[model samples]
Target: MPIPATAPARNTKSDTDPDALSVLNHVFGLPGFRGAQEEIVRHVTGGGNCLVLMPTGGGKSLCYQLPSLLRKGCGIVVSPLIALMRDQVAGLLEAGVKAAVLNSTLSYEEASAVEARLLAGDLDLLYVAPERLLTPRCLNLLGRADVALFAIDEAHCVSQWGHDFRPEYIGLSVIAERFPDVPRIALTAPADDLTRKEIVDRLGLNNAPSFVASFDRPNIRYEIVDKQNAQSQLKAFIAERHAGDAGIVYCLSRAKVEDTAAALNKSGVEALPYHAGLDAGTRARNQDRFINEDGIVIVATVAFGMGIDKPDVRFVAHLDLPKSIEAYYQETGRAGRDGKPSSAWMAYGLSDIVQQRRMIDESTGAEAFKRVSIGKLDALVSLAETANCRRSRLLGYFGETPAAAKCGNCDNCLSPPLVRDGKVAAQKLLSCAYRTGQRFGAMHLIDILVGRLTERVTQFRHDKLSVFGIGADLNEKQWRGVIRQLVAMGHLAPDSEAFGALKLTETARGVLKGETEVMLREQVAGARIRSVRTKSRRGDIAPQIAGSGGAANPGLVGALRAWRSGVARTRGVPAYVVLHDATIDGIATSRPTTLAGLRNIPGIGDKKLEHYGDELIALVKAAG
Candidate 1:
């Protein structure tokens, strides 16, 4: 049951071509296409335009990268972020492809050199920002070059409804009109139906074939926890599960980013803060440190991690709610890029919704755009509060039906709670919001629910309200759930600019007047249990290592990992780069007992194979 040699390569041939598989093998180093990649590549390479909606790690790049290599002319890649374009170029170069990027970060001489290459047709792929591509001089150069294809990376940015919309991207349809014969492919990791339609309409992909890949990252475990002792919970979660893995901790604000990074560092995590507020050099340095060092934690605002190419991030923990599920999915998709198990942990409360909505309200977009943004935020709130499988809820949002009723990797699937009849509770909560003049946040509402005669309750002289102190049986946590679920159910709207004051929407009138029944569940704590189990399962994968002198065998690698783990525990260095998995796998497969044989391993250069040659050989012999 072994996979075919060409299984990973994309096939971009017409029905008449018989050597399609052969072409795939020669160019991409793999056998066949993955998912919709083959069809996408074939469509684009065969002079057909396409709109490809694939998940973050769903081989979207290969759909265009392979075609770029096979076609007769250079591919024009329009990307929003310069850093992301540079990373893609670097990856292509490492794979022995001719690629160049033109961005503002480059000096005049450097930019001119890339342009020279483009004009000479020396590059197979050229990455350019949309703003630069639309320039008169750049367009003139592109016209002269033998352009085979045009690709819009992060195509969702073109849509005003998308989480990361950019006005510049909407102008890219000009490329299509200018280069009518060259095939154009629009690619994005996360986009919904509205955004997808907007992308097609704005980018003029009217007659293009569209491919929508299933937006499910099964390898990522999702969990949402209540925001109580959030810092301690996050620390414990990181320490226990991701002890030696690269991860991101996303905060809502720059100050929170700095504070969280400091807290993680104080607790022995090698962490850094990144935000637009930081100087360019400091931000770049911190990003580099996170990428190069394993187990390094980066606490940053949403400004960070747009085009990061790190492949082994183990987790993404959000300290605040993202503006939309599309943003959340793209952010969490950064983890487990190497097809390993990873976690997406989030801690959110009513305050996050208020803050995010306030920002949205303050934006300069049209009213229709604001409405769409708010709707997306409400959908995300539903996902967070769902008592059903989190994975199913998330996938369902992107138009995929889940086969299983419960995904064993999510918080609700692992630890489900009993749903009590909260019809009366909902009515009470809604009535409290209405009777209290809809001007308070969750804390004040909780005080009224639990009959806490605090100063605020007495100062407002609102203890005399009929609904006040009526539901003292429910605890503060349960009351908060009622309020959150109300917000998620659209019965209550937390006014953004009024400092998160709770307001009873028109929908609340039904519940208040006993015309509608609201169902609610008490929020459950300790949803991290399933994620912990997944981490333990991943840890059970044995490491493969062998001796240096060809005197030992495959099992020796696992022993070396054990030894390395002990050493790393003492020295606090990650075990992966101390001895890469590839190095260990080679040693185990070859049983390289000699220093020369060890040097023959792919990742073990002479310096490393020589320095640790004796020690590894001895360990292998001891194991035997």
Candidate 2:
């Protein structure tokens, strides 16, 4: 492929052009940008590189989309998944942006038509998968086209720390080498400081301005309950608080996904299973239903969510432990994307931690990689076991300290855990682990400590140890909690070489010597009551949302939803791609009666105003 000869510097005439904000308002129907969006836009429009680390639903799309339109030529977007590209293109078209996607799924004629548009400069943006864009054929075509810039969406795919790492993303740096004049912007919804640095290094954006926004998703009420009968707990969580509400229940295995979906179905909640194990067509159809319909719960593995662009997911429940904090953050970020109240509910137990650690220990990766994986898992364990404010701990993980130490939106802040000094308990547990040669897992240690004369205990002759049977005061679950918390707090480390055998770390010395007091939550006896708070718990102040409107008229909201569903079905796209339920709620609540009034609503952009303005106005008028 022939490279284009030296090209002129990218035209910066649009940098000072004031029409960008006007276009944002008139075309996209947004009054203004939020949270570093305007600054990022100006930087990119002035032909500068940027790495945007914004939270999900934080308007990362606008950072690139606006600049692409403000600049002179078509913006090239490199995305990893076909479903994501389709959703983005559909949403862009709804907002009046001329966007097309080129992927392997397209037919010969479809591909030709997209290429024709590209050559004619008839598109504002073109979304292509990284594999497609890295091809010699596509590179040669891009070398000759009047390219504006490159927007690498979900750019964390370049980092191994991210949940959805894609090897194809490694080749995206070519855009920097080849189209040196055009600005490049990389965006991701989740990345820690290390991952952020790796993204910059790997994407060759070392000199680019990095914008790190706050990772606080205050709209999501964080709740992590101890697991006991996870399915029943999840069922009660669904049946009570979120009945008929759209949500996602994530599992770590395909069998669990299928079982959970089946259980929810039998219990009268409409649920679908999604995973790599499902037939491709079935997965696609299930995903399409999830996108287009409302109140359908999807039970899935991690493979189900990164492609979901729908904004109204009311909750995200985890049936098992996520591999890392990054994965947990990204998955929960999917909920409440529209800035509505939602929940990040989870049920975790000692088994979850042991299973996750074992997965890391048994992995074929190098020791360095395994160490990093353990560190990541330990951080997640910390989050799960923390008696502190969930939001504060979560934010602190991302290097942000919230102004308020206690965020009232989380379960810990709402109903504080019963924290007690467990120094004696810790010493007992640590003594039992050490006396047993630190070669036993938590269950074995628990058995040894609790005087359970199991075969292993008799074979190992641990029953006679001084520390053995000394922990009989604490039940099996309580001992497990002590061990798990110690592991999380770094007082204990898992032996990667011995299938997660308990090993005393240096931190354990302080406890054993009584120099450090271990504080722990006293285990209360119950059936592991699901912490899915359906209403205000005892001694909890209700969270105050500023300027909250009265509840919308259900009849009006129902009518508006019916209209949105009809429009989405007609357009052969997801209902959210057509119009989010949040936008429809705004319309129904305000009862706007004219096209001009309807356009003034927050989410009704130019294309929507032009296409659905009459219908919305008519519906609003008739609802009265």
TM per prediction: 0.85, 0.92
RMSD of each candidate?
6.3, 4.9
**Residue-by-residue lDDT tens digits, candidate 2, 379-436:** 8998999888888999899889897889877877776778989999999989888888
- lDDT (10s digit) by residue, model 1, range 1-624: 011343333233444133344444433333356788777777777878989988877778888887776677788899888667866775455334688888788899999998888778788888999999989988898888888789998899898788887888878879878888888899998688899999999877888778988887877888888777778889988988888778999998899899899999999999999999999999988986786566788999988887676667889999999999999999999987655678899988777777878888899989988998898999999999888889999999988898877877776776786677777998888788878988888888888878889999999977888877988988987787788788889898878657779898898888878888777865555443744434432242222333334433456767876765665455443444356554555566676557766555654533344346788777756755
What Cα-based lDDT does every candidate model obtain? 0.77, 0.83
Model 2 score (lDDT): 0.83
Can you tell me which runs of candidate 2 are displaced by over 4 Å? 1-17, 452-465, 497-500, 523-551
Clashing pairs in 2: none
**What local lDDT score does residue 602 receive in model 2, on the 0 to 100 scale?**
72
Q: Which 10 consecutive residues of model 2 have the lowest summed lDDT?
A: 1-10
